[model samples]
Structures are given as structure tokens and as C-alpha cells.
Target chain A: MPKIKYIEENGKEHVVEVPVGWSVMEGAVKNLIPGIDADCGGACACATCHVYVDPAWNAKMPPMGDMEETMLDFAQDREATSRLSCQLKVTEAMDGLVVRMPKSQH
Target chain B: MSEQIVIIGAGQAAVQAVTTLKAEGFAGSIIMVGDEAYPPYQRPPLSKAYLLGKLERERLFLKADSFYPEAHCQMLLGVSARAIDRKAMTVLLSDGSRKPYDKLLIATGTRVRQIQVPGAELPGVHYLRSIADVDRLSPEIVAGKKLAVVGGGYIGLEVAAVAQKRGLEVTVFEALDRLMARAVSPQLSAFYEQAHRAEGVQFCFKTGVEAFEGHGKVERLRAGGKLYPADLVLVGIGAIPNVELAKEAGLTCQDGIVVDRFCTSVSDPAIFAAGDCTRHHGHNGEEIRLECVQNAIDQAKHAALAMLGKPTPYREVPWFWSDQYDLKLQIAGLSRPGDQLVVRGDPATRKFAVFHLREGKVACVEAVNAAPEYIVGRKLIADGTPIAAARLADTAIPMKNIV
Candidate 1:
């Protein structure tokens, strides 16, 4: 199991044990987190699963692909740390990694 | 260094455009003016899950409450953009305020087209478009009351599915020969019609609503020389683009606001249009307007890139999906009326994909309860890969191997 921590917009942190193959967005959704509405499922079409990655964990995550980047352009309140959680696959190196949900998932 | 980007309507397109602007490194002041009070939300679920009490109001929201401040986007709700002063680059609001903009995006979307029949304005006669519409109709759906849906299109069929699931007697009236005739193939429509009918949904195909017979509320619908008794009636004939504001502002307007391939207004460079309101020039030299969430998001991206001067031509394939009674019908690409359809798999087994071919090229695909085929079909349509009809119809050939 891969443990992941999500820091919501309200600054509350939740630690959940997720399967390695599932995306971070799937983990949040399956856990019934407050934010992260994956409207189009795991498809890169909708940007409702946007999250701001902790700068410390940026090196551990893969670079944002063109499709993910293009999808992120549709997310509200984007930042340099912004990444679509659906595109972020959970791995062992992602333990203790923190991600903040966007204020809006529109 | 204050550049202003004003979005005319605060629906999905406006919300996505603002988000895209921020992602693309636009530090300008973004303002979204919407006539509705609520923030951007998903409308597709209104007819299905939301109406059936399967989804809460919060679940239908596109963003949380903290979205506006976090995105640095100002949302002026319950305010309509009345007019546009092209020469001064300003938008006149209904509240007697004028906002200047360096660039403007018209995402007014569309309004439900109502049937012009007698008793059309009856109290119980409704059209589903906004959240309020769904909220008003939810109780009726849950009560398992009789519902007469006056169109066999996607909206009507979806509502019928939800109503039937909620134990209501649903009767869909379609003027066309079959359900979803304009958007789907005959075989696909027949499958849906059969599925819906199996779920106790009655249909009146090739029949038009002559009138609604009721005094204070809807009591019955007169169609096909017969009166179908009903407690409630919902008219889902179609939708017309909200192009009055654009037309009054001297913009090129035909069926919708005319825009180039880049989603820029053909008559003005600073003005761009997207979503259901703008008819952009398609690859086939036809001006087409799509009313899907995919189009809204993709067109918003195109418009945002164009506004930033990093223009990308809008060439993404349009796809749409509808959920009805355990069936997830996903469509990849657009198909015209006369397009050829080839079926893969068994319709009788309730699992199949119908491929629409144009000039022997794969033009579009409609899949029923087939997610993998829909995904591959989306990629194939986007790639414009020429697939042989025989190979497409062959079940042994995997869709992944078609590429």
C-alpha cells in the first residue's frame, strides 16, 4: 500500500493508504474527500481533479505531460505547483507527499 | 501591467476560460458576469442523478466556495451583459455599469427551445436547463408521478430513464421517426428505445405534440390524434444559441455567433467566442456549434491560447456521453444524417459499438456500455485514422489494433 497525504483547501490533512496503480485523484475520490470531482473519470478531458503539489515532492513526481498540462489549463486557480491528480500515479516514492486541492474544481 | 479579460457568461465555458488563463500565465484581472446566481456547475447530471436524488446539490458543483478568491477571478452573479461597445472595448451590464476589457470572451451558451403549442406555458410544463429547473422537477420525479416528455432526444430519454428508475410512468413523444435521430444512428437509437421501453418507458415516435390539455397545470398531452394523460409534461425539443447580445453588438451572427477556426470572432480580433454560442468553421468548411462539455472546455482552451497570442487552431474531435438505465452510451466524433454505420459486437447481448463512416473513413463511433471502445474511438477520431469498414465490423480485431 502507498500512503498519501492530502492537504485540503481548508488546511486539513488526511492520510490514506492507496493502491499503487490508482491515481492520486482516484484515491481522494474513493476516500470521499471534500474536493477533487473527477467528472470525466480518469480521462484528461475534465480538470476537476486539480491539486497543487508540495514543492518538496516535485522532484519525485513525473513531469507534467502535454495532455495533463492542457487539461490543467482548464482548472481554476492554477499555479506553478498545479498538477492534475488524475495524471499523478501513486508510487512508493510518493510516501509522505502532500497535495493541496484547488479552491474550485470548475 | 493590468490586462482585463471579461467573460460574458459564467457557465462551464467561462469557468474553464478563467482557469485556463491562469494556467497559461495570464496575470490579468479576470471578470466573469453571469445572469444566474449560482456558480459554475455541471448541467448534464441535472436530468439523471440529481433529479433522482442520487446526487446532492453540492455534488453537482464545478468548484467549491473558495474557488473565486483562490483563482483571483471576480464572479458577478445575477448580472447580465446587456450590450457591447466594440469601438470602446467595453461591456454594458444590466445594472448600468460598463466594464472595459482588453479582450472579451462570449460564452453565453444556449437556452432551451420551447415547443410553440397550445398550453405550452402551463404551470407543470417545464424545460430542464438550469439547477433551479431540476430542483423544481425533482419532487415530481421522486413521487413517481406520470411524466410526459415531449421529445425523444437525449434530454427527454435521460429524464425518462431517471423517472422510470424512480418508479414513474414515463411516455416520450418524438416528432421524428426514432429517438435521438439527429445525433445517433438508427441502430443505436433502436437499442436505446428498446432498453427504455423495457424499463416501462412508453414512446410515441413520429408523433408531434399538438397541445397540452389542462387549465392550471398539465393534465394530458395531445399527440398523434390521441390524448396521453399525464400529471406533468417536460418539453425538450431542442436549444437555440443565446446570440442576442452578440448580434446587437454588430458581431457576425448566423445561426450563432460566427467565429474563425481559432474561436476568434470573424469581425473582431479582440473579441472571441466559444462553447454552444459560437459557430466555428469546422474542417469540412461547415459552421457548426457543439453543445457538449468537451467542446466547451476545448474551445475555451483555444480561445485562451489565442488571447495570449499563442494561437492554437481548434481541431480536437468532439465527443459526448449519455447515461440511461445501466447503459453508458459514449459517442466519439460527430456524424451527419446520411453517414454509414457499421456495428461491432452484439446489440442483442447489450454490448456493441457502432462506427460511422464517411467516404470510407472512420468518422464517428457510438458505444453502448463499451468504455474501452469509446476511449479508442476517441483517439482514432482525433487521429483521423482511416479504418476499413470490414475490419471495424470484425469482432476478432481489437479496437486497439485498428491504429
Candidate 2:
């Protein structure tokens, strides 16, 4: 299991151990982490699951696909490191990855 | 004294009511009655991820299992609201009990419209509606099997996409001339038809399924004046609003439970309805019923506020999306007849948008793999912004800059 940290806009942090195949959005949703709406339920159709990734862990993950890139344009506080958490699948090498949630996601 | 709010049908709107009431600091008793065994869950993935076995049962839930109890709301799962005693402000349940409520919300949603044909009751024929429906259909969705899907709507096409990806031989039959004819524009329907064709999904347009023929179970279907062999038959024609309960309770029902802009029953102030079960007079003064998650969630929120005595008219721009074989279609606004259409991007690349204009103002937008257009198009529709046809067609002008 890869341990991932999710920080909310108010600075509240939740650290959960996610299975290798599950996405970060799934982990946060399963752990009942607030502010990560995942409104479209991880279909990447809705941008409610927007997350700002820590630059250090961003490189370790796969680059944003065209679909995810197009979806981020809907996020209220989109940043360069912003990604749809649903598209980011967890792997063994991604242990201790950190991402911040936007207030808009709530 | 805390007011008790009773919500019938624990689907998307029902669950949304529970959360909204609690978040808005409504110190009231919340009672949710659902006919399903589980709490409110997301149904979109049932045909996509859950059917493909990528999603688990627990994840289908809109909220974690414990959230309901932790929120101090009472849930009556595997039960239903049989009758509404408006005078007594109580609901008769299928379990021979009554639940009293100060306010009531009817979010019964819609039910799958089954194909009324011979051999419809066969074993291998399936209709995807509830979680249980998909559960029963999962084992049959295997590779090297033949699937004959009836109806070329979003649900039918989605099942075809999943089946195609699973290496199953898939064929779709649509009575209309094109796919998603009622929901999308002709350009998109043609685009999806081609996309699915490239994925080896066969399509029979302007055809209808007359009957299903097989031994004891479904083994073939008769459609388009020909009989096609099938291991399993899936029907996704569309859905009819669940309004019998409301209609029997003496509320006005037209197509759906007739409600005002506030989601309140036109005949009763104490009663409210939302989701696919509602037909409200929209901002445009037209009675409309939308079957989408966004409408369900937003309308439920509006109903909660109305119950709080802070009534806000439900006038949010309508939006919907569909996923099929790596193609995602996002639609916004309602397209009316006589609206002029403008194509924004090249359909050849499969990343484009079609905008509907009424009286020189943006009316509706259908975007395929175009996120910027959908995001901005929604805002434009909401604002009723006017745009020049040339500017909308010019992909060089960033979407955000158009408004």
C-alpha cells in the first residue's frame, strides 16, 4: 500500500494508505476526506475532484492526459500543478505522495 | 422542537437532501426511505466501471457507510413510501408503518422502460437500473460473448463500449436514424457512430427490436427485420419518470410530478419533488424535465432551501456527460427548435464543440473531448450571453475570452 497525504484548503491533513491500483480520489473518498467532492464519481467528467500536487511528487506521477487537462480548465483555483485526482492511479513508487485540495471542491 | 423532513426514494436527490439539510444547519429530524437495500449511491458507474468490474460495491455509495449514522439521520433501507397522507402529514410505508414529517420530498427518480416484446422475460435478458440489476448482468459480460444491445441512447452505447473493450462482439440497434438523437445534435451522433464503428461495434440504425428469441434463456434477438445471435441481450431504451405515487396522492402530474421553480408541488406547499421525477416550469417559461446528476443534486439543494423558507428559483444551466470508448461527450443547456448551430472545432480530431444559438444568444453546447468549451459554455448559457457566430467558430479565440 502506498501512503498518500491529502491537505484541505483550511490546512487539515489526512494520511491514508491506498492500495496500488486505486486512485488518490478513491482513497480520499473511502477515508471520508472532506472537500474532495468527486461529483462525477471519478469519471473525470466533473472537475470536483481537483487537487494541487506537491511539485516533488508531481514528477513521479504520469503526465496529465488531454482529458484531464481539458477538465482542469473548469476548476476554480486551477494551478499549474492542478490535476484531477481521479486520473492519478497509485503505484508502489508513489508512497508518501502529497496533494492539496481546493476549497472550491467543496 | 425539530421539524421532521421525510424524503421518499433514496437515490441521488434523496441523498443530496440529507447532506444539504445537515450542512445548512437544519436541526431537524431527517428520515430517508429507499426501496433499494443500500443507501444513496452513484448509478453512472454501474454500466461503466461496475459492469467492467473495476468498481466495487462499497465505492458505488455516494457517501461512506458510516456517514449516514454519523450525520444523525435515520435511513429506512429496503423499504418504500407506499402512500402519502397529506392531511395527517404522514407517509405510509410498504412495511405497514407510518412516518410523520413536517416537510416531504419526493425524489423517486425514474424507472427503466422495459422492452415490451416476446421473450423479454428470458433469463439472459437484462435491464440496467439499480445496483442489483448490474450485479446480475456482470457474469454475462465476458469476452468472446455476443451482446445485442437494444436502443442507441447513452446507456445502450455505454454498454456497447464496455463490451467492445472486453473483446466481446457487440451490435447496437437504434430506432432513430442516429444515436442519441433526442439528447445530442446530429454531428455528435454521427461522430459517435463512427467512433464506435472504429472500435468494431456494429450498429443498425432506423431499426427496432421486435422480439427476443431463444431456448430457455436469451440467445438471440430479432431486430431490423433480421434475427441476430446473442449470448445476452441488454435493453437501454430510456426511462419513464416514477410519478404514479405522486399522482395517486392527488398532486398534479404531467409527464412528471408537476412542480414550480422552487421544486415545490404546485398543488401542495408542504410537499416538494426533485430529480428526474420532477417537471418544473423553467426560467424560459417552458415545462421541462431533465434526467441528469447535476439537476438532481442542484434541485435537491433548492428543495432543501425552500423547506428552510429561503426559496430560490431553480434556474441553473443544465449539463450532462457520457463516456464511451475513450470518447467523453459533455452537453450544456437545452436545445430548442429553430436554433442555429455553430461548429467550434474540427470533428476529424474528435476534439470539438457544437454551439446552439437562439436569437444570437448562446442556447446550448455539445462538446466532445473539448473541456474549455463545456466549462465556458455552461457559464455562457447561464449568463444568457450573446456571441457572434464567427467568434464562436473561431477556435483561435480562447473560450474564456469569448464572454
Candidate 3:
């Protein structure tokens, strides 16, 4: 199992054990996290699953693709470390990564 | 040094573009001008859950009140941008204020196409688009009165579903041969016709509404050489893009404001357009305009990238979804006029996916009450992979492996 930590806007952190193949968005949604709506259900069509990865773990994750990059641009309060959680497929190297959710999802 | 970006509409496209700009690290002054008083909100739910009083008004908001400040964008509501001075790079609002911008985005979107019948302006007739329209119509749905819905598109059908669920006598009048003639295949349309009919929704297909008969409020609809009585009428023929501002500003306008794949105005590099208001060159070299929320958000991002001088081409597959009753219809890719459709799953069970093939290539997929198929179908459409008809029609095989 791959462990992931999600920090909400108020600086509250949640640690969840996710399957290796599941995307970060899927992990949060399956665990019933407060954020990560995933309205389009991991289709990368909607930006509701937007999150900002910790800069320290940025290099550990895969680079954003065209589709993910395009969807991230529509996310609210996007930052230089912004990534669509649905696009981030979990791997062993990505364990213990931290992501921050925005205050609101448009 | 920072530049100013002014958007001419406060619709979905405008809101998405503002967010996209800030996300891309564009430190610029952003201003959104719109005729509506409120910020951009979801329009799809207005005719469904919102109309049935199942969803709250706050949940329908696209963003919170603090979103603008957090994103560092300014909104000018209840004021329309009357004209654009291209030479001076300024937008003139109706209030006689001129705002200069280094880059201008046209996301004015579209307005409901009004009926040309005699009693179109009648008191009881309405069009569903803005929150104001939904607020006025919700009480009627709750009153459990008779209703007549003109046009059989997603809007009309979704509203009819909600009205019927609310225990109203609902009758739908479609001028075309089938429901959603332009958007869905005949099989899918037939499935919906049967499903709605089963839900006590009366259908009057191939009927042209000639006039609305009433003294001050609508009482009857004259169509198909017959008069049908109604307590309220909803006219949802379609929508036409709000391109008057762009056209008046001397930008090239056809069916909509013409833009390239980059969402940049074909005639001007400084001006870009997106959303339902702009018709961009499609993959097949035809001018195409999409009205769904996906297009609004995606095209806005493309336009933002263009404004940033990134020049990212917009080539994502167009997808749309509609919810009616208990069925959720998701469609991916664009289908041509005469594409061959293959049906998978049983319409009798009210759960199936229809695949449209053009010249042995998958053109589109429409799934009704089928979630897994819609997810897999979208990926296949995006990949443009060819799948055998027999394989697609076989329900035993999971769709994920087909691609």
C-alpha cells in the first residue's frame, strides 16, 4: 500500500493508505476526503480535483502531460506546484508525498 | 511590468480564463464585465435538481465570493461592455467607462434563441438559462401544474423530467423527427422517448409550434395542426452566440466569432475568443462551436495560453453529458450526420451505450445509465483507436481493453 498525506487549506493533514495503481484523486475520493470532488470521475475533463504538491516531492512525481496541464490551468488558486490529482498515478516512490487542497473548487 | 487583461463576459468561459491566467503566473490586472449581476454559476443543474428543489442555490455557484479576491481578478457585474475599440485596445462599457487592456478575451457566450411565434412574449412563456429564470420557474414546478416544453433538446427534456418528478403533467413538443436530433443518434433518442413516455411525459414529435394562445398568460400551444392546453410553456429551441460586440468591433464573425485552434481571433493577434461565442476551425476543417461546460473551461485555458504567448493548440475531444430522471447520458467525440451507430447493452433495461462509427472509425459514443462504458468510451475517443464492431457490441468484454 502507498501512503499519502493531504493537507487542507486550514493546514489540517490526513494520512491515507492508497493502492499503488490508484491516482491521488481516486485515493482521496475513495477515502471520503473533504476535498477532491473529482466531478468528472478522473476523466481529466473537470478541474475539481486540483491540489498543490509539496515542492520537495515535486521531482518525485511524474511530469504533467498535455491533458493534465490543460485541465490544471482551469483550477482555482493554482500555484507553480499545481497538479491535477487525477493525473498523478501513485507509485512506490510517491509514498509519503504531501498535497494541499484549495479553499474552494469552481 | 504587468499588462491588463479584460474579458467581455462574466460567463463560464470568462471565469475559467481568469483562473487560468492567475494559475499560469500571469501577473496582470484582470477585469470581467457582464450584463448579469451575479457571478458565473452552473446552468445545467438549473433545469434538473435545482428546478425540483433538491439542490440548494449556494451549491450551484461556480465559485465562492472570496474566489475573485483570492485569484486577484475584478468583476464588473450588471454592466455590459458595449463596444471594443480595437485600434485603441479599450473596452467601452455601457456606463461610459473605457478600460484599456493589453490582451482582450471575448467570452460573451450565448443567449437563448427566442421563439418567433405570435404569443412568444406571453406572460407564462419562459426560457431557461440564468438563475433568474430558474427562480421564477421553480415555483411552477412545485405547484404541480400542467406544463408544455417546446423543443426536445437536453434542456427541455431535463426540465420535463424534473417537472414530471414533481408530479406535473408534462408534455414535450419537438419540431424534429426525434428528440435531441442534432446531438444524439436515433436509437438513443428513441430510448429517451420511451423512457420519458414511461415517466408519464407526453411527446409531440415532428410538430411545429405555430402559436401560443392566451389572454395574458399562456393557456394553449398550437402545433402540428392541433391545440394542446397548458398551464405554463417553456420555449427552448436553442441558443445563438452573443457575438454582436465582436462583430460591431469589426472582428471577423460568421456563425460565431471565428478563431483558430489556438483560440486566437483569425483577424487579430491581440484579441482572442472562446466558449459558445466563438466558432473555431475543427479537426475536419469545419467551423464548430460547442456550448458545454467542458468547452467553456478548456477553450478558456487555450485562450489564456495564447495570451501568454505559449501557443498551445486546442485539440481535446469534445465531451458532453446530460442527466434526465435516473439516466445519465455521456457523449464523447463529434459524430457526423450519417454515421453508423452500433448499440451495446439493452435499451429495454434502460442501460446501454451507443457507438457512432464513421468510415470504420469511432466517431462518438453515447452512454445512457452506463458509467463504466462512458469512462472507457471517452478514452477510446481521445485515442481515436479503431475497435471492431463485434468487439464493441459484445457486452461480455470489458470496454477498458478495447482501446
Name the candidate that leads on DockQ: 2
DockQ value for model 3: 0.06
Per-residue lDDT for A76 in model 3? 62
DockQ of each candidate relative to the true complex = 0.08, 0.60, 0.06
TM-score of chain A of each: 0.95, 0.95, 0.95
- Which stretches of candidate 1 lie above 4 Å from their native place? A1-106, B283-285
Tell me how far the alpha carbon of residue A18 in candidate 2 is from the true structure, in angstroms, after superposition. Answer: 4.1
lDDT of 1 by residue, B365-385 (tens): 898866556667766776677
CAPRI tier for the interface of model 2: medium
lDDT for B352 in candidate 2 is 95
The list of candidate 2 runs beyond 4 A from truth reads A1-3, A16-19, A92-95
Candidate 1 displacement at residue B369 in angstroms: 1.0
- Using TM-score, give the best candidate's number: 2
Give the alpha-carbon lDDT of every model. 0.84, 0.89, 0.84
Question: What is the C-alpha lDDT profile of model 1 across A2-27, one tens digit per residue?
Answer: 88889889999899887776689877
Docking class of 3: incorrect
* Lowest lDDT 10-residue stretch of candidate 2 chain B: B63-72
